[model samples]
Target: MAHRLLLRRFVSVTLRGSSGPVRSRSSALFPSRSSLSWHGTGPPLHHQAVPATARGFCVSHASRVTFNVQNQADFAERVINSKKPVLVDFHAEWCAPCRILGPRLEKMVAKQQGKVIMAKVDIDEHTDLAIEYKVSVVPTVIAVKAGEVVAKFVGVKTEDDLEVFIKKLTCT
Candidate 1:
């Protein structure tokens, strides 16, 4: 009906200057239509890489704020040697407090964008890491900068407290 016509017009306007017969309203929106290859069925397939400018807008920071430590080597490489300050969260799946703190800490860290990153380490899976860090508690958060421990805390903290802790770490 009327909605379908409006959608068709919108598509034509947005896809102007494409390799296909359809003409778009603005060629600047998509500079390289050659990257896209049309097949007989379904949507067009992308055969080549698209330049960043042609890809439209994108976020500069890393989208993921939290990651799990696979092993000792992973912790050494990702957390110990990270350029930005890292908040190492040593936790256990069975611990209720650990479960609560993990998500809150991730939310706070994500708010900081890429200023700080979070490393999740399961105490049960990686006992060696917990022993090395002298973490007897189930939920422990240690802030490391330049391969050194800057600050640490144990037990679950309030959301406001977690935000303050993250802010302090990012500030330094």
Candidate 2:
């Protein structure tokens, strides 16, 4: 019991920097991998859209697995109920378009960290949530602000599109 409590405390503290304090969760229920799960050790502030700088750019999460948000309900709570902006990518492993868009999205993640909670959802695994959002296509990206869907796209989107929308988005 004490170990569980300590673990929860550590996870909560570390997670708060990006996703916020960890709430109740079964150990196995939590995903071991997530690009967004890193705290201040968070991904650098360089845009994948920009030229690789010595300090800002190292490598993208291209070869590594994309974010795994399976079964973790509280995870999205920080996103949907955010004090900033929330962006979600609904994708499938089988879609070639999703594959092409994956690196683009990951690049955005590196740049948008403190400003936005960049999240990804594997529609193949989390069907119900996808249905709720009415995401009918792979690589559907949605931006949420103040717990409401503010911007949406049904196919692959460019970083410029996201940047322009974000420039117009309000975060107060």
Candidate 3:
């Protein structure tokens, strides 16, 4: 019981991030006074109206294995020359189909574990890659093996279809 109490105390202290004295049980259960004041009175000192960066990049989850190709060199090193089969998704931020297919494709690729990997290339950021691959359309998924493109498809595909495609790629 004492250990549990201490554990809870540590959690509360860490979560609250306040150096002041601890609050009563009833008060601690609800929102802290500072949080409520900031919410009611508008932006806090540390709060920002807009993100500092022009665009926010999605960080890969710990369990996920994905790569973002930043340039021609990165694409060559990570995708073309990769030992494992690679799925390159040529996408753009403004494209609706790309947005829809990106996450679905990622989930499908994750199921393959180490057998295959997914690489994302933003067409807007890397025009050279899109032109080199002859990718006129968004969400163009290309399967590369041994530094060569083995399979290519455009538009969104169902999870089932993607699974079938990946299985075929890995089988060979």
Q: List the global CA lDDT of all models.
A: 0.78, 0.64, 0.80
For model 1, residues 55-167, the per-residue Cα lDDT tens digits are: 33345343476789999999999999999999999998899999899888888888887789999999899999999999998799999999999999999999899888888
What are the per-model C-alpha RMSD values against the true structure? 11.4, 17.0, 11.2
Clashes of 3: 0
The clash numbers for all candidates, in the given order, read 3, 0, 0
**Model 2 spans with C-alpha error above 4 angstroms:** 1-67, 170-172
In the range 1-172, model 2's lDDT, one tens digit per residue, is 8797666565544444334323333321354544355355543343112221222223554423234565547546656667777667888999999888767766765565456666678888888879989989888988778889888877776878766655555444
CA displacement after TM-score superposition, residue 103 of candidate 3 (Å)? 1.1
Global lDDT for candidate 3? 0.80
TM-score per prediction, in order, is 0.64, 0.56, 0.66
Give the distance in Å from residue 6's predicted Cα in candidate 2 to where it truly belongs.
Answer: 22
**Could you arrange the candidates by lDDT from highest to lowest?**
3, 1, 2
The residue ranges of model 3 lying beyond 4 angstroms of the native Cα positions read: 1-63
Name the top lDDT candidate. 3
lDDT of 2: 0.64
